[model samples]
Target: MESARIPFTERYHATQHGGIARAANSSVTCKTAAGRTATPCAAVQQGGAGANGHYRMAYIDVDSDARTANSSSATLRIPAGSRVSYARLYWGGSLRGSGQKAAKDNGRVLLAEPGGRYRQVRADTMTGHRPHSATEGFQASAEVTELVRNSGGGAYTVAQINMATGHSTAGVWGGWTLVAAYENKKQPLRRIALWDGFQSLGADRRELSVRLPGLRIPANSHGLAGVVAYDGDRGHGNDTLTVRAGQHRAHTVRDTANPANDVMNSTVTDLGRPTMRWPAYRNTLGFDSDVFDITPALRSGGDRLTFRFTTTRNPGYLLGALFVQTDTRR
Candidate 1:
């Protein structure tokens, strides 16, 4: 844990370009409660795939075509008249349940853009994998900006994620998110920044602080934050995300759909609807692709903003992505 924790580093950073949108879905499914709370439900209905404390889990095979071993599709919606400037796909899970053979298969996957055939894609960026008891969590990503720029937006399916499917001491979990930043002259000038790495939540570093520069916040500006992480429990409590304008006091970003104490709980959330996905599960069992408002935390006229993610007394989590979008001076 010490070795894996000390080296929390960066994977991808956008040099330039686009508004932000994400298409995400869980690769695994399990039986759980109805309302999708941390509280255990005795009813144990067949719910969408997510990180739950109870029930057996399995891979989600939404792609009946079945040219690959495992596959799932998610919807990436870019507004009309917008061109994609950047896109990255992230996927991983516990290799322990699937046996160590998958360790060699890390960073390799299949991605199919809307109306296109399957193409091999590898994690051209950082690959984060660490061991914790019986569960070894790993996350890998690949840049698909070119594919996305040409293909536009729709249901994008990813296959061969190479994650385990079943109940484990740590709970079987894996998923993918297609995050794209677009350019639309019709929209307000905005800054879209993305940062990713294999950073630990509690093992060695309890906090992740990212400083983003060259942002201008005007009055009545809209802001958003997005994240991808692994192994976060449903109600482990004490997890928080905070953001601050340069030289200003920090404010904890809050949302009704997301609990401050459990920011990493499994789920893929967007702004209340237009939720297009193949298997839109409220809980992803262990994977998380969450979005929340940071507009309340913004201050006018800043060249930089700092983003922080911290855990006080929760089990470990490996953060894979951090994205920020805000209106800026063109």
Candidate 2:
């Protein structure tokens, strides 16, 4: 039987190698010299080296507990006037637990958002990690435009990344500002999930919503919040998304909507970084792909809202947070 494809928001299950590499959201790959790191120079070329010589490049993966490693602090240059919007962390790890509680401690890996400089993004404390009751598991972290942290351990190949200027949904009028080292590899893309009741404006039974896939937003720095709804196993609804803006009380819950729904504990700081727990189990927490309604006290086109709409969802689950925007810059 064909497995049912849930909402447009979905998590990826990358196959593992061994030891720490087996953990969820963990991955590793080999690249050329110029392609050795996150932001590769577009002018530079990669060829002459033998199989052994081409095996030097490594992209490290790190999560909450492992963000302080030496590998996470690599440096690079971001064109002086480059305006960074979003940063994504590609995680590769093992998911071999059963039932909801089995993967509770090791659910998802969360990377920290960029502060003044680009730092790694982590999962919410309550949702990211589930206890490692299972056997061998690993976790890895990827950097965005080289500004974010790149912890060593579970380095995976960079599937696709375009850091051109301006948020061009058209993809026709911009230069490749930052290119992934593993652009050639078949890396899993990020997934966007949505929910009702969590926003302030309330769900729109009529209009559909959508946004750019893998786009970055500041951690708690006031941007658009996207949402999606499965609506009881009826496939997907309109791609349209409705974002609600305002001061709404936010809380975390598990994938399933049961009393035992897994809860994620998180808090956004002034610096806009959220320290969250990695979810060990698998649920659709960050698996929606469309709109995010508010918790009942706000509206959509108001002051608390920022961010413009993008077009599609790449593939896997993306770990990050959303905030109310005081201004408009999308």
Among all candidates shown, the one with the greatest TM-score: 1
Specify the highest-lDDT model's number: 1
Report, for every candidate in turn, its global Cα lDDT versus the true structure.
0.72, 0.22
TM-score of 1: 0.87
User: What range of 10 consecutive residues in model 2 has the weakest lDDT sum?
Assistant: 168-177
- What is the Cα root-mean-square deviation between model 1 and the actual structure? 3.8
Candidate 2 error regions (>4 Å): 1-81, 85-94, 97-127, 131-242, 246-320, 323-326
Clashes of each: 6, 86
Tens digit per residue, CA lDDT, model 2, 3-41: 111112222211111100111111222233323432221
User: Where does candidate 1 stray beyond 4 Å?
Assistant: 1-18, 31-53, 98-101, 131-133, 272-274
Task: Please give the lDDT score at residue 264 for candidate 2.
Answer: 15
lDDT of 1 by residue, 154-202 (tens): 9899888877765565667788888888888777778788877777777
